[model samples]
Target: MPERSLAAPKPALIEKVLMRCAGQCAVCRAWSHQTICESCLGLYARPLPRCWTCAARLPPAFVGRPRPQCGRCLQTAPPLDRAVAALDYRFPWDGLLQHFKYHQALDLRESLLERLNTALSAAEVEAPDWLLPVPLSIERLRERGYNQSHELAKALARRRGLRCKPEMLLRVRHNDRQAGLKLEDRAANVRGVFAVEPLLAARLRGTSVALLDDVMTSGSTLFELAGVLLQAGVMSVQAWVIARTPEPGDE
Candidate 1:
């Protein structure tokens, strides 16, 4: 009658596409959000019982102990008062992170943030007043075009209603990537690389902080950053990371 619908109703096309998108899981393209919906998350982000101070896997013997921190933390405390990580840095998570951190796949950052968000929600933990990303040095920042940790903090801060102070902690020096270093050498690699902005001294003073990062390998980078915050008069320090690597021998 009215030239019959040559254009296939715009609204119908939009609805069809939107429906397809809605049906696909964020991490895995699938048909079931209700059934295997969290498939990707379940496979890649299932939470593991971890050392309270460092997020290291709890030793088999320490499974139900009263103290949750690892033995090393018991001997000598870590800089952060507490810490937690979403997943162990391996498998699909590692590959996803490589894309986010190195390949300029910015969208993947949100997936990592979701994993961290899930970790915090499932744990009986306190939220910090300030969330700061482990900053990048000027040289690296220029090259990467973005700081994965900062992007993560910003997204999580919105979800948690916390302040994301990406610039509060400044990377004064550039350190080599900690990926390939031996466990013993990792700590030394990041030494003296992070400092807090003097202008924020009063702002950060008395504020509890949670250092944010993409991965916690030896716990050195975050540990170093936490110490700087505490030294600057922050009341307390905690760490929240997208992933925590297993101890060397556990591999």
Candidate 2:
């Protein structure tokens, strides 16, 4: 009789072991059941005063204000009615986001979503009528294998028991990269790039929506999309981003 080969461990069992064992925190290298660990989250991701419209970090003096608005936003409001960010685009978060966005580090999604959800809860943000992710163009979607914003929106909708309308917004055209571009140029870069799905446009009429994205730099992309949504009769548009870029030279 031929000897039988030893059975290999199942993928589910290996996943279970990984979940049970403590792993190194991405920030402090501390052993933890979480990716970023609770301590690091407390220190690095503590809520701070942010602009009501753009989610920019406000001066410490504005800490207790009911609605903190940054000076830039005060001069001219952004398209978004409100915006909230889970973390700043800096340090360890920048690196981690890069890995998640470009290298397919899908495991980081849970911890990232946890931080965003906690921030949203603490902010006492009202649930919108729908959660819509800023869509990617066909070429980019094929290249990336996933829409990061859609993934975030789906996870957030699940946590909040809200509707996620991924198909409601569509990226109709490819735009130049906004990095290193001036604010006006960035705005121009994204203009006319987004449109609402004709079939579903009526459902969005007079309904508020929250847009989910991984990061906001100049925020041109989100603002542009918000304008399109508003034109399609969306009552209000709010942005929920995983991170916001700090002001220039603002350590």
Candidate 3:
């Protein structure tokens, strides 16, 4: 009889270390199981009252304004119906975001979800029928090996028991980064860059969808994705992102 080879043993040291450090963020000393420490999390992530329509930070004067809409959204309505952000993208938070998006810190998904979940819980909004992550271009996906937004959406859906539709919307163009661009240029950069798959369209008909993304800067990308969903007959499109960048000259 031929002798059978045994399967290789798993690494026990790494597992032991991770277990000991459970719910602790090494960077911020936050008691988190995944990424970011609690102290850093509190210092970096803080909630802000924002315009429901555009997710822009609400100025003190605008606090009492009924159904407040930002200047940009008031002049030209965004494609999406509503937007929600978990925290402001500034300071140490921005550092974490840079690391996650550019350096590919996959473990950051846990912190992202924790922050998003808190925001969702506090908001006075109904859950959507479907959750769709802003999709990446095929070429980009091939290079990155994963879409960070999709990963976060999957975790969120699991936590809330909502259906996560990863293939519903897609980025058709590999456009340039919008980080440093002017707001006007950002809109043009992302215009006509997203489309909904035909099969996915059928599933979205008359359904409410929550678009999940890691961050909302100029919000051109979310607007573009919402346009595609609306064209596909989605009843309403709402956006939920981990962070929102405050525009200059806006309080």
Candidate 4:
């Protein structure tokens, strides 16, 4: 008898299994078929006006502008041409992201990715030529066992039918985590830390690209990464974050 070849499980089947295994909503703890119950999502992730370049929540006064943007972004533009955030990094999402990013609870990925997909659709975000996840340094990758942003980017690429380039950008230097750093110091921590992969640099020229990340806090990392891509000659860079950290006193 010949040995049989093994086939991989379907993505839909895998997602279904993960959803069922969640058993309850991560936010409200309500028993639900999905990882996050719809009610909790509705209450917490309500769409809000945000800066087109930075994804910062826009004040009511700024609403209805032809192109909405916060004062900071207007005075000095960010490296991103456009930005879209699925939710705010507050309360339930902040805690949930900690678990998803630090605890190896990858089952949350399906729910998270779906939220981002929905936001992008609602925002009418154009599909870029390539989707690039901010790269993690070799040492960090060894410790974390995975790059959460890469996971999110790959899923988004599959859903949107764009090329996913996980290694196109390299974290040439490993720096301290941005969480503990002061807002003023965060930019310094990430400056000159990212570079485009030399062999792929030529291909990126004059192409539109999107940077996918699990969260954007202070925009330091994304800004630095975007600047590098722009310097590498990409025509445009968009920031797509699952969550954005609101500034102090921001609703």
The residue-by-residue lDDT of candidate 2 on 1-251, one tens digit each, is 99999999965356446656788998899999977888988888888789989999887898889878988889988988899998999888999998888777767787888889988988889899999998999988888888888877887797799999799888888877677688779988998999999999999999999999999988899999899999999989999999999987668
User: What TM-score does each of the candidates earn?
Assistant: 0.84, 0.91, 0.84, 0.94
Candidate 3 — what's its lDDT? 0.80
lDDT of 1 by residue, 1-251 (tens): 56765666664345335534546554466874321256666676666778889989876777666548877888989987888898898877777788889777664555567678888887766888899988888888899998888877887887789998776778888888888788899889988998888887789999899888888888888888888888888989989888888886767
For candidate 1, which ten residues in a row score worst on lDDT?
11-20
Q: Roughly what TM-score does model 3 have, to 2 decimal places? A: 0.84
Candidate 4 lDDT over 1-251, as tens digits, reads 99999899986578768787647888888988888899998898788788999999988777666669888898998999999999999988898888988887777898889888988998898889999998999998898889999988887888889999887899998899999899999999999999999998999999999999999988999999999999999999999999999978896
TM-score of 1: 0.84
Q: Which candidate is the best by TM-score?
A: 4
Worst lDDT 10-window in candidate 3? 11-20
lDDT of 3 by residue, 164-251 (tens): 9788787777987788787789989988998888776788899999999888998888988888888888999899998888789752
Better of 2 and 3 by TM-score: 2
Error of 2 at 163 (Å): 0.4
User: How good is model 2 by TM-score?
Assistant: 0.91
Off by over 4 Å in 4: 1-12, 20-22
Residue 18, candidate 4: how far off, in angstroms? 3.2
Question: Best lDDT goes to which candidate?
Answer: 4
lDDT of 4: 0.90
